[model samples]
Target: MLLIVGAGFAGLSAALRARHLGVAVTVVAGRERAFDAPECLSLEGVRALHDCGLDARQLQLPPVREYISRWGESPMLSRAPPPGIPKNIMLGRVQLLRALRACATEEGVTFVEADELYRVLPTRQGLQLQFTGPVQELVLDASFAIDASGRAAVLARKLGVGRRTFDHLVAYGVRGPVHGLPEGVVHTFSVADGWVFAVSDSPGQAHVCFYTNGRLAGRVTEAKIMERVPYQIRSLMSDEDMWLASGVSAANASTSLLDVPGGTYWLACGDALQTVDPLSSSGITTALQQGAAAVSAAVASLSGNLEPMRAYWLESRAHFDSYVRNRNSFYGFGESAS
Candidate 1:
């Protein structure tokens, strides 16, 4: 039996693949909703979608481009926005979860809701999982445990896996309606505190986020952040327009910078292995791709051939490193936001 934690894109993908391989897979997801990606484009913009193999024809929205900012020392305008994306191409967190649930159920994967895993013990006969929920605490036995628990890295942290944090910058986001904006024109601007993003969800809905230092964090009032958008549009939004995961949500109506740690799992596929910046909009693309990657590794590991798993981990690490480098370079104004 295989036990997987979390049910985001990566977790769901892993469960689906494992079940297809005839393995008994069970998933434990904390919440049913996956946060929707902002309609906004990243500095590298949307063209990266093509690189990730997202089918453009399936989305019929027109492309929007504009002059954004340069990050590095050069004082010049950065031209050429990411390729414009069709509104239909983007899937909200709720829709993604529903789709994954359907796929996992059809594939015969066992899924449990609101169950939190507290412990994992790898024994001679397989692995044992201790979980707690509304019902009661239960123990599950499996041959292997895949920690798709994401940034929590519950299993990995317990096993002494270290983490690396990037520079001082935090991010907060709110999604709602906005008008009179180009579909593909995602704007990244610098303020006295840090950077702010204006992302479009559709013709009317938009996602606005601000990144500020810890000291300046307290001032990002919900009202001010909303005001960052057009006045007429701001009036149409409410506080609940934002979706914040625990620990990352703002309470004083301010934005916070979080530690950007490039994490890997002791064992597993998907986000448990690595996570990219939402700024790159590669979350879903990579989650789907990594799900396949994890399945390949898990099969190899099970067959006593660990080489494939190791290779997969190496490739994941290399790709994320490139991503970090690309982001730093873009912020420094060296490369086009590719």
Candidate 2:
């Protein structure tokens, strides 16, 4: 049996794929709601979802065909979708998680919802997990474990694997009713201090965020962000529309893979392994891909062939390195232009 931690896209994908491989899989996730913000589903992400048996069209997500950007007082620049590129969709993050979880359930994947992971002990036969929640205590033993607990890297950190953060960027945002915005286009404005992005996920509801260095982010208020945005966006903010702001690292970070794919017993995927800047717009796609790859690695390792796990580690490392390089280039361009 395989134990997957966290029930987000990564963990659910891993659970579903492992079940398809005829393996017994159980997913343990915290009780926290997944609806933190809005997310954009790129063409690649949409394909991944479809491969996982999700129909994006059936979800009724808004399709984005273009993007409008304004950089530091420059005139608005309109970008058309590139040929052969599939339409990208924007939807509420929580809604997608719920859909994925429902699909996993339909696939016969067991889900254990807990408030916290109390302990993980590796024993002679396999690994044992102890979880605490509102109802009662539960323990699970499995031959292998997949750490899809995201940036927390629960198992990785406990195993003494280290992580590296490449930048000190932070993003703060709010979600509320926003008017006077195009339905299917993302609007971005580059300010002197940082950048702001706004997109309407539904008819009237939207998500807006400001990405800035940590120091400035600490002092960035909603009013300040409103001032930085274009007049059209600023004018649409209604006093009755609620706003809330929270900050998280927008930097590139990755865990050192020294002990990952270790001895065919444990591995990490998704944000647990590496995280890219939001500008790359690859988080969900990368997470789903890694989740599927983790299942393949787990299946191969259980069969006494460790080659696939090793290869997966190398591939994950290479992907992170390439992502970092591209992220740096993109940020550098914005800085130079400013």
**lDDT by residue for model 1 (72-157), tens:** 22222233223453222333456445656776788788877646667767677566778787577868786666767766666565
Distance from true location, Cα of 279 in model 2, Å: 1.5
Off by over 4 Å in 1: 36-88, 182-192, 213-215, 218-266, 333-338
Q: Candidate 2, residues 83-172: lDDT per residue as tens digits?
A: 443445676678888888899899899988877777888888688888887699889898999999887777777777877665555676
Q: Please, what is the whole-model Cα lDDT of each candidate in the order they appear? A: 0.56, 0.72
* Residue pair clashes in candidate 2: none
Q: How far is candidate 2 from the true structure (C-alpha RMSD, Å)?
A: 4.5
